[model samples]
Target: MGTNTRRALTVAAWIVVVAIGVMLSIQRFRDAVGSDIGTDLRTFVAAAEHIRNGRSPYTEFGYVYSPLVAWLLLPFPDFDAAVGPWTAASIAALWGAVAAVTATFWRALSWWQRPVLAGVGIVTALYSALLSLDLWLGQTDTFLPLVAALAVFFASRNRQIASGVSLAFGAIIKSWPVGLGLWMFRRGVQQRGRLIAATVGTGAAFLLLALVIHGPQMFSEWIDRTLVLSEQDLVAYSVWGAGRHLFTQSAALEPLFVAPIVGTIVSWTLAAFIVALIVITLRRPGDDALSMWNIATAVVLLIPVCHLWYFVLALPLLWTWVAHALKGTRRLESLIAVAVMAVWWVIVFRLPPLDNQFGESTPQYIAVVGSSLVALTLSVVLSARRDADRAVVVREAVPA
Candidate 1:
């Protein structure tokens, strides 16, 4: 494609993405108001109200979030009035994240690649099923993923403290971004020491503040609620969760008679294994960018709940990879990777063919499990190879 033609096509694609986003937003808004059912934003507002009224959110409505989240919401004028505005605000903030990440990619590209690649990358990311689900559900996980993205962007620019603080804030709100922090630790001994100190110090301060505001009992209650929630029936869209649904639904697997809770156990086991793998990869030096992308992917894949919104954590990483592919010889491989991912995400998260209960159909199950496994394996291999290549370059640079 000619440069001008590609740029024009990318622009047209972005227009389509925007139109789709607007349509989804209108439908979601109608659903939110008409159904009288509360989304996560409403839950968050209710929890904030409890905190404002000097009650425990955990005791009131089983709010699983850390106390810091409730405290953060205290400044909102009225809890009931805050939901729509906060949802809108989150959407706006998510756009900012898209811009930040796009700019990050632009910075890494040649001038000729910037306009076309930026438009294509941002449009591809924003149009994903994961992001569409995120906006429609009023999921506050948007902010955390945005923070994690900003952390990577800052770290890439050598802003250690800023990066640490951003990742630490996300970790304080939600635990997934801790993986990003660990990836940054892979930079080197000196940088890791600085990053760890800043992250730990910031996180410790936040916890102490929460402890002072809400007593030790509140901490105990929060911990209990989180643990209880984790052990709930696995409705999660994660690898093992989807596999469990598939297995339970499969008539062929019926003879095996797998226990329902077995899936939950397996998901947690996989989560631990993924965590170990990422940590080990980070501990060894590699391309910092590659490490960040791999760590983000690993964290999202291993998260027990793995809600659709949570997958937004992978947006920056995915788009960056896409840009690299568009500019590289392996464009076909990247296209296949992305197309498979979009299909898996749509089936597993956006449009599950089966009901909440099990069913006869197993296509969604097979698609989700197969695509997830393939993507995860591909990510690990690519990251390891990039790291090895970087190591070879460093070795060759030194005097022989």
Candidate 2:
């Protein structure tokens, strides 16, 4: 078959897979949207409503995100009835926007690659599966990925100024996306000017929006709320917390601090691996598309407090990696990434109760931490190979 025909088949197969995955998730999706999403949405609604009533939303209400994020939610009424449907629609719209933006970036690729890219997009769109949960709960995690993806996509395209702005805006809304700035800086001086412009413009825009929406006092309140949230112990809510809880209750593990410390070590190690990958990519030439996607995915995965939805950013790269891996020239590194995703899916779906009397045991920690290590190691090795290939290409193209 012609390459084009083969590519078409690949895309058709990807669409079928995505459709099935979504179909399987329908019941879970409904349950999530039907339940309370999270306190963040409630807080957002209350704050916006308070502002509409001439009360300072930031001061009287609790809000940790940037003013622009809250302002975006202001158009909807404060009542539960209004917030429910509005939040759902907003999330769905954001998901669609992110997918569209991703597609735009992939439009220039070869016909065969496009199908793989589409598969990546679909996987990215569903990476968190938690977004469906958030949708059910009427939450904003759905919009988070959209903002982050746009920021990275724009930045990679040399629209540094816009990219910076998007990054700043996303950061204001949720602090985690700021990590993209680290990736941006690591991208070097090739597009620094645009990056600076975008960062400053976006930051200024957000500040101005804050001033208009809640007056100057809003900034102080935002700072205060952020500090409070930052200090709150996450032990009971996160992977580490769940692991610790499980080990203590179920197994006879003695050192209580071991689980959290081990988890922290694993998380930071993964982060360092990602940073190294980015540094290597920066030193090489060619593979710009893959390099950009790799950096974005690594940054998202490396963040300490990553939730299930955070994985959405990794989906595009994961798809690309898998497509390349399955094409018969397997990279041990890519296979590891695939393994990590599989393990992650199992853990997320089977999460233990936060307050379950049984503590997280050594076995559970081993499973999670071991999987993370394998994934990170694979990422590093695969990234090295990718960089090596690019170097060879560049060298070969140089004049004798």
Candidate 3:
């Protein structure tokens, strides 16, 4: 067959795949409406309404997000009433936008890989339960990955302020992306001060604006609500948190019996480990893509509590590995990534009998967290071995 014909066939196949995925995704969105759809967005919209009424969202609505988020949604006053339908449409539009952006980046690839990459991205966005929940809840989690992507893309072009703004906005929405901001700063020692300044300045501007809208009292109420939520026995997708679930039958897993200090110690220990992973990855020679992947995976693993949608943070990292696979750089890693992502999709979407029927959550939590931890561990170990081998080669090459 001619190359042109083969390319045409590949594109046609991708079109079919994407068309099917979109139809299925829309059905899922339709099912989600009037049934716990846009729960988080509803909370935000409710908070906005509270704010508009000269009431504190933190006190009135138990809103955990920073006050700035409510203000951001002020333009959409009708969000509360129509969050479900609006979010469904938004999710579809965002997936299309993501596919188009991903395609632009892969323009150098062969025609087949371009559509395949785009089709894969679209399918994952549309079909995965993580993203389904993200859209259904009208969650900001979907937007964070885009923010991280833009940060990396802009940093690649040496657009420091734009990158900083993206990262800062993400961090303001949720604290985790501050790690990404710091990663960008570490990439350029000379640019370090300006990067930090820009990130901090951006965050502060929003925070101050929020405070002005509310009052000094809002800070205390926000902190109280945050602390209350933290103490809740939320089933998180972290190694430590999953351990809490897996061993719930055992007395050792009972937080009530354990000292509060013990819990705090475990949290800090995991955090330190994450910091080590970030440092190891940062010291290695690689492009911004690899750095973003390393930092994002580490951050996700270390988050104290994580929902299904929180895993979206790793999407860009997975995409980077997929790109490497397309280039035949590391097919093994890519295969592992594909396998892990498949397992994750199954766990999140619950594929019928694989459901978390019991509240214990061993099946789903272990599957998702275990697969991610294994992939991350392999990446770190391989990177260390590669660096060690290079060091030995350098030593042997020195004049004797």
List TM-score per model, in order: 0.79, 0.73, 0.79
Q: What's the true lDDT of residue 364 in model 3? A: 46
lDDT of 1 by residue, 1-400 (tens): 7899877876776677567656655555454444444456566767878888888877656578877666666777554566566556666566666666666666566555655554544454444555544554556676865777677677767777877787788878765566566665674534766777778889888878877887778778877787877744434456556546543544322212456677667666666767766775676544455566667767777665655456566555556566666556346665665665555455554553333233334565456555665665565566565566667778999997
Which model is ahead, 2 or 3, in terms of TM-score? 3
| lDDT tens digits by residue: candidate 3, 23-99 | 86776677566456566787888888787888998754557888766776766776655565556655655464455
Q: Ten residues in a row with the worst lDDT in model 1?
A: 247-256
Residue 94, model 2, lDDT: 47
What local lDDT score does residue 342 receive in model 2, on the 0 to 100 scale?
61
Q: Rate the local accuracy (lDDT) of all candidates.
A: 0.62, 0.55, 0.64
Best by the lDDT measure:
3
Worst 10 residues of 3 by lDDT: 350-359
Estimate candidate 1's alpha-carbon lDDT, on a 0 to 1 scale: 0.62
Error of 2 at 11 (Å): 9.0
Misplaced by over 4 Å in model 2 are 1-29, 60-62, 82-129, 155-162, 236-309, 323-336, 349-366
**In candidate 2, how many Å is residue 202 off?**
1.3
